[model samples]
Target: MQKPYLEISHVNKTFQRGSMLTDVLRDISLTVQKGEYISLIGHSGCGKSTLLNIVAGLTPVTSGAVTLENSHVERPGPDRAVVFQNHSLLPWLTVYENVKLAVDKVWARESASVRKDRIMRALEMVQIAHAMDKRPGEISGGMKQRVGIARALSMEPKILLLDEPFGALDALTRAHLQDQVMQIHHALKNTVIMITHDVDEAVLLSDRVVMLTNGPAATIGEILKVDLPFPRRRLELVTQPSYIKAREAVLKFLYERNKFVEAA
Candidate 1:
């Protein structure tokens, strides 16, 4: 078997709040294979985003380690690109420029024409080629998010990290963007890790869903396999019995886990 592309080993994180040390993640370990799509799901404050930041090397782990291709994660690099929940695009830059910024930064040594071609290709991959010249302020929320995704993909990272990329959109818009994101992933076959609270979205998008325990020290509670065939469609997936069952399992886990955390 091929080696896992990313590995999180006995990871822990703690924060200093005034005089007290609060643990946010505890003994969390996972391995992600190449070209796999995994979703991390939990309630708010469950440290899902924290864990993604850790994997992305945007934040450090207090203990243990995160390794990509056998190299320990110490700092953020072009090898791992992130798409944040907030659609962190520069307001002054047009859609094409926003993506070009990332490509240029990562591929600075490449010829200017090569970087331009890469940027345009990434925008086209996300189906945002038509909006290439539009500024972020002029675009819809979904379009802005697509620009964010395009920017990330332009970097051609080994692993793509998404921190609740669709969390802020309306339900219909979120669903539509999910399809677009899934299609992009399918075509690229890049390893992806997404943090989300939406169980249905997780089931529809991931090869596996890793449900985290509630925080002040969150850990992996369960890793549920999504056996549904790929090239999934939202409406078709919703109507399928296995998809429904998998979603219910994740929801039940969250509901029960959160209740236990509350009572403690």
Candidate 2:
């Protein structure tokens, strides 16, 4: 049998504040094939983002390991790129400059023309090429997010990590960005592990939805396979039985498991 492309082996994570020790994730193990799209979904307080951070090498695992291509992941590198809900673009830089900054660092050995091509390629991939010269403050929220994703993509990272990347957007912009992401995944086939609370987005964008149990020591509660085909259209899937079934399954799991959620 072939080994997993990326492996998270019996991992655990904890935090220390003062004299208190809080267990966040326990015995969490997952195997992801190359070029797979996986989503982590759960209510607030779950360790979904923590797990993503571990894979990104932003934090140390209390125990166990995460490896990519059989090499241990110990620190943040060009191999893993992350995009969060905030976009985190630099206020002083224009859109083109924002992405160019990453390309310059990752492909610094390359000549100036090569670097420019890298920056333009990523901007075009996210359909933000025309806005390259615009500053983040001059653009809308959705455009800023496009720049953020382009910046991450410009590095040509092996794994893309997203933490509620679309949570702050309006419904229309969010849907549009989701489509852009799906198109990019189809074209690039980059391995992705995204943190999301949206059930519909999970089912639509993921090959598998990895749901976590309620926290302080959250673990995988269930993994639902989305048996739908690629090039999924949002409007067309509204009445799709398989799509409906998958959506309902995720909703069922989320509803039954998140009982601590108090009704507002």
Candidate with top TM-score is: 2
* Model 1 TM-score on a 0 to 1 scale: 0.96
lDDT of 2 at 208: 97
TM-score of 2: 0.97
Q: Model 2, range 58-176, lDDT digits (tens) per residue?
A: 99999999999999999998999999889999999999999999999999999999999999999999999999989999999889889999999999999999998898899999999
Local distance difference test scores for all models: 0.91, 0.93
Tens digit of per-residue lDDT, candidate 1, span 1-264: 888889999999998889999899999999999999999988788798889999989899999999999999999999999999999999999999999889989999999999999998998888899999999999999999999999999999999999999989999999898998899888889999998888888999999999998787889999999999889988787789999899989988988757743311
Best by lDDT: 2
Off by over 4 Å in 1: 260-264
